[model samples]
Target: MPCRTNEELQNLVEEAKREAPAGKVADYIPALEKANSSDLSAAIFYPDGTCYSAGDIKDQFTLQSISKVISLALALMDRGEEKVFSLVGQEPTGDPFNSIVKLESHSPNKPLNPMINAGALAVTHLIAGVDVTERLERLLCFIQDLTGNHSITYNKDIAESEFETAFLNRALCYFMKQHCVIDEDVEELMNLYTKQCAIEMNSLDLARMGCVLAMDGVDPLNGRQLIPFHIARICKTFMVTCGMYNASGEFAIKVGIPAKSGVSGGVMGAVPGRFGIGIYGPALDEKGNSIAGLKLLDIMSKKYSLSMF
Candidate 1:
């Protein structure tokens, strides 16, 4: 079915937009600095192929950190849990997502979890392909299947910008490489990882992808098992434990859904057999999550009794 304009959701969006000014857009990437911090949008996709949306849902944004979930899923599918977890841990960290302290302090020199930058880089290195082109194509194809948007691709400018300034990520790669956690060349891995982060899509597309995870890897519209059920469960588990940077604990208490947020002001929520939600608001809080988007989910979770806890 088609996505219908939702006035109730629109009202929520307007209310959430009020929180935008209180947060700042992610300026570290430089390319993301150009976004309109005042803009907010949302879309909800149900299993029956029905969708509800509010605000400018068509606005596109980079996946940023949210791409971690997808890459983790793909890595699991390619290398299985044993090999993938050997390079990264399953625990959440109290530090920032991009922090390198854990890799230095932790035993065995592995990242804490796949949601963080260090762990995500390790997982991306595991995606099976002969080269960056093949690996990226495989990931893009998987994403295309998930969103059913064949035209979806990475934002070249955003990818270039991130690749150029990813000093911290490069450090993470080298650390992992030195420990033999990831054996690939750092530059090629960085190329793949940045493009993965730069994958672009709108809230509607994001919601649909979330819906697939909500359905436990099945594409609700076509009934295809896009990802293994157990692997999907693993991804959702991480979303609950570590998806929202360091604020995941508070998010669980308030929103209580399997969700991931990107610095581009995008939040993708999977309501597990109920519905999927997508949100975009470029203004980021100190923790790098979309401030307005978090407020929006908190409000919706309470008003609609959406907490899965």
Candidate 2:
């Protein structure tokens, strides 16, 4: 097959947006309720340092659940694999990302995986910091360093808004604490996690972030080993198995790439030694994934034979 040119990618993005129904935008958070339901964008960074983008590629969105990917890697760097896995299992829950069933009924009360809300909160609690602000700052610095965007920062409005309406998350953390799974105070850890979720970035930023993992933890732009190879491997493994929430298995079979999605309509994928991609389509499905973005990745993956399997 011929190489995918920029025009073809742009055409594909437009096609994907047309397929995006007027789906529901996340309104549970007052801040997220403001997203334009019609917005769609995508960007990719290849190992050669070229960036390809289409649609609303320059538009910004909060990291939302995608922040878990970076936070998980940092957690491994901070807490190490043994301590991290002891608190959160490395398996899919088959329930909603925020479901409380497995956390309650499962043995040891560990979260099913780090991609879920419960697991993310517990993982955030393990990052060492003097205070909530320090912990959040550390996360921000880590992402900025990897993305090479010094100006990257959080959307405090979203963080505060999500915090105010974070009833379910609060309940989950409280339960984990009671079960001896979480180490930090519930409110403090929630603040850290919320702030991390509120970190804003465009598709290019996400593509760059994914590119670091594409190189197995080394930032290609600078040649720095931002994360250990083993740590990046673990993060990518979870992304493949549980990153798309309940649709992960289907995505694996169809798209066959290591990817993570966030409720803010963002998807991040790393193509091992080849490329890193980011997609955004605010219209989400019942499963909370970007419906159009998923379709776009499936098409691109098939067209280029990007599937690992």
Candidate 3:
């Protein structure tokens, strides 16, 4: 296949937008249900210092589960890898994101990995922030540093809505507590986790953040060390193994890179020093991944040979 030029890539994106299926937007949260199903945006950051974008590249959307990658990296940096692993496993559960069967089926019931809601809540519990305000401050500061964008903040409305409907996550946190996996208060843990997921970002900002992980924790635009190399490696590994809820396996087989997707219609891909991709499409498959976003990634990965493995 011939390589696609920037102009051709832009055209391909437009064409995808036109034919993309309008899958279900997450309805558990009323706000997410209000998102435009046809909205699609994509941005790519290449290692050679070039950037390409099309569609609603500048449109802002909630990070949702995409924030998991960020907080997991932060927790790893704040604590050592071994310590973090003690609380969260690295294996993919092959279960639904919010499934509770594994917790009771296995001894100790530790979460299978940090990419799931259970694992993510465990990671958030490990953060040193003593309270919700402190945790949000640290998270915001890290986002600002990583993106070089000071305007990033949580969408309070989204946070409130998730908090209202977070029964499953709340139960997961309590289970972790019962199993002695987390030491923090359960409500505090929920607040920190929910607020992190509520962080607002557009495709371009997320692409830049993904670039940090792609560059092995170094912020390419400023050369600042946002996360340690080992931390970045572990986060990428988890993303590859367990990022897309139950659909993670298929995505790894098809896209062949470490990527994470959110219910808010955002997907972040890290190419391990080659490039980072950010795409948003509010409609999701049954497993809570962006349908159009996945299609776009599949096409681009095949065209550019962007898979890490």
Q: Return the top candidate by TM-score.
A: 1
> Clashing residue pairs in candidate 2, if any?
none
Q: All candidates' lDDT scores? A: 0.94, 0.89, 0.84
Q: Which pairs of residues collide in model 1?
A: none
Error of 1 at 153 (Å): 0.3
lDDT of 2 by residue, 1-309 (tens): 213566777888888887677577888888988888888888888766788888877899998999998999998999899999999999887899999999879998989999999999988888878998788889989999988898999999999999988999999999999999986778887888888999999999998889889899998877889999999999889999999999999999999989999998999999888889988888898899998899899889888899989
lDDT of model number 1: 0.94
Cα lDDT of model 1 by residue, 1-309, tens digit: 223459878988999899999999999899999999999999999988888899998999999988999999999999999999999999999999999999999998999999999999999999999999999999999999999999999999999999999999999999999999999899999999999999999999999999999999999999999999999999999999999999999999999999999999999999998878899999999999999999999998988888888
- Report the alpha-carbon TM-score of model 3 versus the true structure: 0.95
| Distance from true location, Cα of 33 in model 3, Å | 1.0
Would you list the clashing residue pairs of candidate 3? none
| Candidate 2 lDDT score relative to the true structure | 0.89
Instruction: Give the winner by TM-score: 2 or 3.
Output: 2
Whole-structure CA lDDT of model 3: 0.84
lDDT of 3 at 244: 87
All-Cα superposition RMSD per candidate:
1.6, 1.3, 1.8
